[model samples]
Target: MIDIQFRREDSNIMSVEMSGHAEAGPYGYDIVCAAVSALSIGTVNSLSEIAEIPVEVVSANDSGGYLKFTLPTDLTQKQMETGQILMKSLYLSLKSTEEEYNEYLRINSLDGK
Candidate 1:
């Protein structure tokens, strides 16, 4: 199962962490994992590439099935908005995924109002 946690700060997303595999199918054929990966990686890319604000803390371990990212403190208003939009989009996508693949995924929102 995939354990995904969204850390919030004052109702805003502060960070995101995900671990484990969906195991919905074979390694190359797990649609759940692929969808999750696309959301997470796409969020990062959008924040950095499109928003021009690079996330200072990002880690990934393919073999261990882990990925984490934290928003930087110095982002400008536009960048922050961009990041939040992408993250919220991710949250919605993951929520939908959870609804469809509840057996292979778990999502938790932590420490944010």
Candidate 2:
């Protein structure tokens, strides 16, 4: 199963970490994995290319799968807004995926509590 964690600081999404394969279908044919990957990679690209925000990020595919993004400590107001929008889109996409594919994916509430 894929495990996803989203972190929030002061009511703002501060980071997201996802790891593992969905194992929902054959490796190359897993829609769950595809959807998750698109949301994560797309949002990360948007944050860097469109939002133009510097982010602490890491990704790996060697063992299972992994991706993480941490918001910069200091951001201009516009940068913050754009990054938030991108991350929020990710959040919503993952939520929708989880709703339809709960057995193949999971969203762990690893948000700073």
- In order, candidate lDDTs are 0.84, 0.88
Q: lDDT at 52 for candidate 2?
A: 93
In Å, residue 56's CA in model 2 sits off its true spot by 1.5
lDDT of 2: 0.88
Highest-TM-score candidate: 2
Model 2 weakest 10-residue run by lDDT: 55-64
Clashes of each: 0, 0
Off by over 4 Å in 2: none
lDDT per residue (tens digit) for residues 38-89 in model 1 = 8888888887788787775555654758888888877788888888888888
Q: Which pairs of residues collide in model 2?
A: none
For every candidate in turn, the CA RMSD to the true structure comes to 1.7, 1.4
Candidate 1 least-lDDT 10 residues: 55-64
Provide the TM-score for each candidate, comma-separated: 0.90, 0.93
For candidate 2, the per-residue lDDT at 92 reads 88
